[model samples]
Target: MTSIPDPVEGPGASPAVPGAPPPQLVRSPLSDGEWHRLHPLTPLLRGGLFLIVVIGIVFANLRDRLVFIFLPWLAPDIEDEVGEWEGAGGDPIDFIIANNLYVLAGLAVLAALIVLVAVFYTSWRFHTFRITDDDVEVRSGILFRTQRRAPLDRVQGVNLTRPMIARLLGMAKLEVVGAGADANVKLEYLSTANAEAVRADILRLASGRRLSAAGPAGALAPPRAGRVATLSQTVGREITGLIEGPEAPVTELESVVHIPVGRLVASHILSMSTLGLLFAIVAIVIGVSQGVTWLLFGFVPAIIGFGAYWVRSIVRSLRYAIAPTPDGVRITFGLFTTITEIVPPGRVHAVEVTQPIMWRPAGWWTVRINRLTGRSAADGSTDQFTTALPVGTAADVERVLRLLQPGLPDDERALVVQEGMFGPGETDTFTNTPRRAWWIRPLSYRRNGFRLTPDALLMRRGIVWRKLVILPLARLQSIGLYQGPLDRASRVTNVRAHVVAGPVSPFLAAVDRDSALALFDGVARGSVRAAFTDRTHRWAQEETSAPEPADLVRGAESAPAGASESAASGTGEDRT
Candidate 1:
């Protein structure tokens, strides 16, 4: 691996030319393994904007008081009004005015402003992050210091987020997602170019690939430009993005699927949440008309909250796209505050394709996955992180799935979407529940079944809210079979494939007893075989010398049959 050349060194350097701009100095912080400070404007972008807004509100409210104290000549002519206002409260401004401490007050405000500026500047200076071959680390503190690290090998994904304000400033944030809850480390407010460059570096390192002799393409930071030129370029790009769409990061491949605006809006409108909102409105109108006028207080706020949530959901999905990259699948979404998430190969534990009863008419479906993002639901944005395809047609779902699970064979991919999600039990390849199990799930019994493939296990269930769950053999942690009293009497069982904690549930209910036994046995042996042979965690290595799809399946099939049966029947559980 060769060190990246500094912009001022070797070929990057140029002789001075009269009347021409000087050469720009570009630095590659990621390659240096040294602690680097965030953007100088980080504090302002993070919290100073909110502080400015708060100050503006306070200043507006105290406008008259300020005028009376500093500009008596411009004060309102209503002396009685001033007296009445002063008499109503023990206000600090009144005390300052009464004591004629105007100079002191001015000094105090100026001192506070100075202190605030110092805090912001100090905060920006103290907050620094570094990237190395093994981990990404961040350190921050004023008095109570804190440090966080995300190991490159354990990284689940990397996300680059550009909030609206930060986007306009040509800045973005990078989050290196760890495998455990609340384990993510973030580097907030880097230049857009640097953020993208750092993101590429992290993913590249995590993929077990060294920088090539020529240096990774994304490692070369753009030449730093003059402030005026930089600002103009940032604004121009932002305006263009608003009209067209966010520009694809250099690391992203061409999108595998594109979700149209019309389709996205229609999907949300037809959702059960929207239907519930409509019903609530109807009920509220009826209640108000029938002498319950007080309902307005609650109804108004409820409507606003629901409308805001709905609109936000739609907006966040506006520029949604999924693409394959060298390191993983890159999912990009959001209209204004764009986010690009890179989910590396083998990090995904499970995949699910679902369709609500309402969506069936329009042939729309959604795809979600089980992956450790190291963020809990409290983050509020976890849903966006887990959703691979928010809403799309069957073909769109297939394309997204192929990008997400590249090892899945072409035939298996077709079976997953066509048979696993939409096929009837009789004609599909899945081993479906027997008719006797109909009593357990009357409506969905015909659709409920499980299919075992070489690389994954597909479980299809639900009629009104259809779902197809795909759990890769390599990621399966454990397998269990359950038979409640009712299931025992019906000669049926439930099978659960446990993986990392995530939104997708990989459990199939009401499976025939014998079929469940076989599934348990097969998965027990297959998971072990797959785990031993799985090299996807170091995806770059696999990419360079990967076996054929058929060979992978064949490799997983060679596990001893006796070991699987014994493991499955003895404890009624198999731990991978």
Candidate 2:
């Protein structure tokens, strides 16, 4: 560990020279001006040479079979050889097959090996990466040379992924998830140790330090006080577990919450992915065993597709964890494609917690969020919103909730949050969907509702997978009201809240038309009030002083008595 160096008055202590280069946070991994190539194994790890070889071999086999079967037309001379074999009392088909098989196999193997070697060599020769003070650059491609650069400052976070094979070989891929869609840089197949070091170096550079103005010591400003623990510390704890006990508690440095592997597996089993995979497997097994070859055509593709999706989902979420950092909240997870995402301070737009009916008994919930960062290969495309936590207990949920919504009112925080999630219409100040909405969604109409808090907008929907979205009013971007033909006939409207790039933002579905407008008005008013309000994202900096519950109770009590009574009359009983 590098200790904090004592104060020293040196060249760096004085203001930088008029034209001198900026002080580097650390030495660049590359030479000042040299173009460095990637690890020699990059081609095998990332190049499509294996795919090319497989296709080449398949085509070779097909060509050999066609030539043997159609020799009479394809090569009229071969017909004479077949006729000679029949004249010598050997079957023509047998003669041709026996003589051609071995030669074709040898030629196919030779051709495949040659093509694989050429492609792999060409890819390796062209691929290179370079690190500089301001950016990390990667250049690759044989036919169409391409270069990608991620500026150190624009780099949001770094992801280090080790697939099962790569992990066994001590190799990993490092990705810098940049601020722009095209700026992201991926360094494929570096030694694991080098990847981790590069990640730390990149983060330190991106953190941007300055000399402390407070003290004569003039120490360099360190990175975030609560930065996520490094990969080495996290891996050390896993290794320590074998000697310590089964499932050693996460170290204080690693994370505040650790999703148990058992919970993760069980949650996955209960998900739609597992169901789809099971259906595909059953169909494929029955199709192949029953000799219904046509069924194979339909089920084979589904089986492969769903099986891949299932495996990737599980790989991407293994060892999921959320840790605090000065830059923002750091999320690290994945078994194979390990991803590290930093939700920078004040960047979160909204948060959603959902509990499926099956998980309700286990008290497990999945959390997701909306933030401002652009799409990333590590984070995934913009459409697939990353899960903050796939499965967590109510307490775990509360911890993450507080982390994401630091400005949440302190008093009755748990009660208020619970009310938002799976609470009845009367819980807190929630405005229930009118009974008339039953026509649109009979199973979950009563469950749809909204609650406007001083700091956030809470909306809940769904019956089977209860979804509760908490949109911090201060982060509200825009609000809209939609009325379909059915909604119009039913006198209902869907109110949607818009945030930056993410899965669909929070929405109140199928509420009474008048109530929807009123809700929209409330949201508009709340957004106006929250505009320009400086909210802190650091969890530690939030105010935690407890006030009387009455202070929060007032929010619920302030809900219009008439609306509450109207909802009460509709439900045939008061919900509270």
The lDDT values for all models are 0.78, 0.62
State the lDDT at 99 in candidate 1.
77
The TM-score of predicted model 2 comes to 0.64
List residue ranges in candidate 2 displaced over 4 A: 1-24, 27-37, 48-145, 151-156, 180-183, 205-252, 271-312, 371-385, 412-416, 436-438, 473-475, 484-492, 512-576
Q: Number of clashing residue pairs in every model?
A: 0, 0
What's the lDDT of the predicted structure labeled candidate 2? 0.62
Pairs that collide in candidate 2 are none
Supply candidate 2's per-residue lDDT for 123: 77
lDDT of 2 by residue, 1-576 (tens): 233222122313222323221334333333222345555567666656567677788778556445646564777566665556556756544555667665776687789878977988777766776555567777777777787888766665566656655554446777787666556688887755556656655665455543231112222333423324543544564444323421212223476677877877788788776777787778778888999788788777877887687677776676677877655666766654455555555567778888888888888988888764545545545433357777888778888877777778666467555676758745446677778768777887777888777778778788898888888776776667888888888888888777655653576778778877676656654554454344333222333465544443344246564443222211111110
Q: Assess the local accuracy of residue 485 in candidate 2 as a C-alpha lDDT between 0 and 100.
A: 89
Tens-digit per-residue lDDT, 483-536, candidate 1: 889998999989888888778999888999988888877777666557656777
Q: Which candidate is the best by lDDT?
A: 1
